[model samples]
Target: MKARAGGPDHRPPLISEHDRDAAVHRLQEAYAEGRLSHEELDESLHQVLTAKTHSDLASFPEENESTIAAVSGRIRRRGVWRVPRILKVESALGRVHLDLSRAVIEHPVVDIEVHLGTGNARITVPRDAIVDVEDLRTGWKDPLYKTRRRSRPGGPMIRISGTMGLGRLKIRHARR
Candidate 1:
């Protein structure tokens, strides 16, 4: 057991991956129950994901949500745009391209929920951003995401979920 920073205890309880996961699940439940705002959830998620020990986890951010949908036209978002805490994107037949390399993302954690019918979706994340696509579901092809052996510490976490029907998801990290 390692002592937490600034704590009085000489030997603190050891933290495990299961513990971290439980914390994250509880935070999500809190958000779903309206006890926490989107921003608050983001901040809390970041802390939970990045915390080295249990004592370091605390605080949360505000609330904001955004959506992008298209029936047949291409859905594209690039340049210096603001990213909301919860972003919902839906497209029936158009390809979706989201470039977050140069976007303004204030939250520590961003959830991108995508629903596609036909065309593929491409997402370019920031160089140091941590991306998780475990919850993403595909109808045909698997997502084209090469996981890095190790990511930099304290990068904002991005979670991509939802369904991609008859289309694939391609994720790449920014070059710069």
Candidate 2:
């Protein structure tokens, strides 16, 4: 059925009795067609009746946010598969170690924004990539600096921005 735009009818119910009835009907049809065993049908019907919301009905029993985070972190660590892509790294405390050696890209660029309450930070880039350092600090030493090197042609662009607190940011090209 088509729903009118910006209307209450367009909004889906968080939990609807009609949806529960439909699920029961489907279970009955499956049992009649011998597609679902008696035990399986009973278990499915119990689940459908016990699920109070659409989210509860749609999700697996073991699914959760931590599982998703672990999967995402593993994928992100595979840097070689992420060349020529923009990466954002943030840490409230502790140092962030990034391995530029494994990052295989013609020009691997990074744009970093750091907000450190304390401690130090270091960002390493491949030797073939160009490093651009920008520090916005009111304190001395700047707590961030890039080693002086002749600008090489066709190098990746690396931009780093540092915020408040004491921390040293070292940028160097990764050795092959």
Candidate 3:
């Protein structure tokens, strides 16, 4: 059955973190190309950040993301998977592991938003990547991360954020 525009299945497209980031990047590029003035770029950036649906992003570029979620058991993402600019992982009562050391990373900055209810999360980052967990919040324990070597000048910056209800988050740089 073909539904009307305002029908249940015709709901607007939901906005994701990657969408907003892509829009901001496009707006910046437009400003750099002299298509948008400074004030216009600022206004567009504000609008992009606050966008909630596809219509709100009408004037900007579009991009998608990936999500890994589970209710129980274990969740793992390793191997040579393609990494998106924004990746979200959620689990209710399971362990989560993400290995980005050998994954295909195409962006300069990667955002991993994890929302775990009751399990630990382990992330293996690239050898030359830089990590920042300053915005991560935890209800039980702090995240464990150690820098064994200095980050390269143009290496990827992995920014991990989100809330953990009751578990540890361990991060380690991959070996060469």
Candidate 4:
């Protein structure tokens, strides 16, 4: 289903005990890897448990047309590049929306990082790609986000880092 700006896309917040467990497991892994300090992990864990709606859990940027336009343009240009053997996405706070409907990439892998303070997130991946997901939290639902990985060719790898706020991320793939 297409998500309109400011329109209620009722896809039933994809939350479940399994989802929660996966998120927590990822956080613990980060701690073990020393990617996150103990203090940071504790704070994120608390926020995740207390969060209710998607907005209560993910991070989003202010809706600025110019900013969106600029970022969109950058993404478009970069997307046109010879698909890197690997790609990476990293963010600290605010929502990230990616539309790959018109994207052309010959790359074999992509990595994403999302950082949050308190909020919810939704991410959509192509319908034919292989994906692996991981999350690191600070409080409650540490990384309060929902992820969908569709099957597609090209074998892309994505890694997301989330912080505080509510938002979504989508990746569309070109048809062969």
Candidate 5:
């Protein structure tokens, strides 16, 4: 059954971390150029990260709450796999991939811990889910590339955190 016009879209159009990150990046640049205040930057970043639709993001905008573990080898997950509530992945000298485009999600929030040691880790998420990367500690240069996806108010959330040492962390959206 179709809902009424102007009403809430039960399943809002999906947004990706990449889209959100780009928006945030722009705001950051603006702040750096003295177009915005520190407070504005923080508030804008929050708005961008929480934006529901692209339009929501456009207005001054923009947009897991886990577990898997991988260590010392190349690990990949994809294609109809089951994503546990808590997944942790640790690579002492290898690679880890946590792809959720085709995975089974049975929770409103998922938590993931990605710890790398002289290795690499890549996380691929669905456009519909949000990607939250916070408190990532790294003493050495651990390059991290990601597409920021925000969790809808009541939708699925993916929380990611960890430490990377001489490793690279990449988080992006899967190709549709």
Candidate 6:
């Protein structure tokens, strides 16, 4: 096990119960959404159940081009990454961080779906963009994460929704 910086030697994250449940839950969600066939779900579920490391879920990102980060494991999308029209992010036992402060937004309205289990998600946006998370969580976790809309004419807008089981959703303003 590799040690975290200034932290104790870490056991493989795959051994965590949250990771195990997250993997299965993600596959079930995909199956329910008609994104996975019966055979695929069965195969994927078997793989996840028997996975030795978190890397075993690499096949998930290949499922779609609209995904900004890893589908099953820890996901972090930062810097100048491209922003798609609609983004779906899922993490079971890990964290999901999307830094859209410098991302290129080609759409006036962007939709983001978040599903997490015992894991947290954070989205950072620039001052110019509008954020609306009211349909999701209560806005007290982070000062920047408000449900109110703040748009400037044709400025971009992001709509975030979905579930966070035993986790939190936070939004922060990026440094200008």
Leading candidate by lDDT: 1
Clash totals, every prediction: 3, 2, 0, 48, 29, 0
Query: Between 4 and 6, whose lDDT is larger?
Result: 6
TM-score of each: 0.66, 0.45, 0.68, 0.34, 0.54, 0.54
User: Which residue window of length 10 is worst by lDDT in model 1?
Assistant: 56-65
Consecutive 10-residue window with the lowest summed lDDT within model 6: 138-147
**Higher-lDDT candidate among 3 and 4?**
3
lDDT of 4 by residue, 18-111 (tens): 6556566766665554344467578666655566644444221221111122222123232332322233433334444454333453334444
Candidate 5 lDDT by residue in tens digits, 14-103: 678888889988997766543454676788788888897887784442112144445566888878987776677766788877789889
Off by over 4 Å in 1: 1-62
* lDDT assessment of candidate 2: 0.54
lDDT of 6 by residue, 14-89 (tens): 5566887888888887766545657878888888888878777624424433754454667888888788767887
* Alpha-carbon runs more than 4 Å astray in model 5: 1-71, 142-155
Candidate rank order under TM-score: 3, 1, 5, 6, 2, 4
Residue pairs with backbone atoms closer than 3 Å in model 1 (clashes): 39-61, 39-62, 40-61
Clashing pairs in 2: 126-174, 127-174
Residue-level error in angstroms, candidate 1, position 47: 22
For each candidate, what is the lDDT?
Answer: 0.86, 0.54, 0.85, 0.44, 0.70, 0.70
What is the per-residue lDDT of model 3 for residues 1-176, given as tens digits with 9 covering 90 to 100? 89999898788878988888888888988666434546767778888888899788748433436898899999998999998878999999999999999999876678899999999999999999999999899999999998766666867789999999999999999986
**Cα RMSD, each candidate:** 12.4, 17.2, 10.8, 21.4, 16.5, 16.7
Q: Stretches of candidate 2 above 4 Å error? A: 1-85, 106-109, 135-141, 144-152
Q: Tally clashing residue pairs in candidate 5.
A: 29
Of 2 and 6, the candidate ahead on lDDT is 6
Residue 74 C-alpha lDDT in model 6: 74
- Rate residue 152 of model 1 by lDDT: 83
